[model samples]
Target: MARVDRGAADVITSDGHHLAQYAAPLRRATVDDPVALPCVGDWAALTRLPEGRYELDAILPRRTAFVRGGVGRDSRGGLSGDSRGQVLAANVDVVFVAEPALHGSDFADLGRVERLLALAWESGARPVVLITKSDLVGEHLAGLLDDVAAAAPGVDLHAVCSVTGEGVEVVRNHLGGSRTAVILGASGAGKSTLVNALAGEEVMETQQVRASDGRGRHTTVHRELIPLSGGGLVIDTPGIRRVGLYEMSRGVDLVFADIEELAEECRFSDCAHESEPGCAVLEALESGELPERRLESWRKLQREAAWMARRTDARLQSEETRKWKVIHKSMRGRGRP
Candidate 1:
């Protein structure tokens, strides 16, 4: 599926044809489950109705999906207890995390990049950090890149400027030959501009960031998959304001692999790394091998991931309970009849 909306999706056929279809979930599919719904980069089975309208029958199994904790709103426009995992994109091979070099501060937000990297790693896709708007940083660009690189270990880092067309080819190289990528970032991070650059045309819209805050509006409202003329596909998502970690596995550990490695060398198996004797993590921190900020960020993300995992567990239990209650009620009704 190229794009999925309320009750329809834009689907691309095997013969390279595009068409919009009324895509609704099958009756057996759980509508509450985000994974059951159609998303960008999904391969779907469609059926033609009597009137010749195409209806989506089912979504094929996904190789990888990008999901995040999503909170639903109440009737009063406030957050409710409907916290579920929302699939951002499905069947993605590469996840491009875009962070502008000249944002609020002089450099990109390393914390945000790390958080996105953790989620990207969880998505089963190769995470690539794109430091957008490198032209504005001038000579400090190299230092800024190094900082981001230190934060995101084992991930490819590229300093790209959509305006000047710098470092775009490096990004484009990853998207050749049927590989699908998704661009993820906050507002005004130059994600849309980068998509346009990669597409080699003005396929996506662009907006100028504010002079004072350097933040752009949510230009791209929905996630749409665009097939590049140069072979490959890209999914462009909206500017995410709050990114909550969903059920995490080894993603957090992978993001903080350096810390994990140090913790392995700690004196105690269960060492908290807090003023412990022979703590390798603390030793690295003291010796300037590890930055204090990185350690703190790792700790913060760990706590968040743990909390979200518990919340997801509770939600699943509640859903299972509700399902049984309905089943019992139906049995009682059948007995009465």
Candidate 2:
């Protein structure tokens, strides 16, 4: 589907035709689970009914689905419980991690960049770092780029100024025909501005960030796919505040490869990198090789990802057990002893 609203979607077909399609009864019933619902980048199977209606029957298997853990009610339907992943975008080839250049030239949030990179890596898509509003921090741009580069490993990083049209084409080159990209960032990150600039038109709404706090209003509240003039597609998503990890250990390791490499050289196989003797990670910290803050960020993400994995496993196990119980009860009832 091109875009998914509350229950409806705008589906684009092979012939470049678009239509508003609503979910069929069965699919609607499954909408409560975000995984089962049709997302903006999903390719869905639609059925045409006699009364001029289009039914989104099913979503095709996605090559890649970008998801993040979101808080939801539990079995008891209480106010708080374990979080589950909400699908962000499907079948994406690249994720552009946008961080706006701060006013008065404050340092960009590399910690958030690390977090976003981990999530992006977990999405099974290549990630590119875009420092939006590059013109704001022109003189101070080089140092900021170096800082972000250290945080992001093996990722293409760029400084893009949407209003001034700097580095915009380089960004667009990533989204050619058949390749899809999603812009991910927090509010006031100049994501909407970048999107509009890339589309070469005012396709997405733009808002000015507050000069005091350097935060932009939530202009793009929902995820929507916009087809570019050059043939590829781009999905614009709302600014994400908290980026909770969902089973991304390898991603974490990849993002922090410097620390990972150091960990492998530790004297003990299970060194916690604290006060352990012959700890390579600790050595790096003490020698100023690895910043303490980065190490802390890595550890925090690792723990959160592990916790999310455990919760996911438990939830699936409970669901499976419940299904078996219901099946056994039905079988026993039919026996009529």
For residues 26-72, what per-residue lDDT tens digits would candidate 1 score against the true structure? 63474778657778998888886788667788888999999888777
Report the alpha-carbon TM-score of model 2 versus the true structure: 0.93
Query: Weakest 10 consecutive residues, lDDT, candidate 1?
Result: 19-28
Model 2 lDDT tens row, 1-337: 7788876788887666556566556466574456666787888878878886677877888988788877766688764425567789999999999998776644688889998888888888999999998888768899989989999979999999999999999999898778999999999998989989998999998888886766778999899998898778899999998777776757888899899899999999999888999999999999999998899998888888888888889988887999899998999899943
True lDDT of residue 14, candidate 1:
67
Clashing pairs in 2: 188-216
Whole-model Cα lDDT of every candidate shown, in order: 0.88, 0.85
RMSD of each: 2.3, 2.4
Per-residue error (Å), model 1, residue 108: 1.0
In model 1, the runs with Cα more than 4 Å from the true position are: 15-28, 74-77, 80-82, 103-106, 334-337
lDDT of 1 at 301: 93
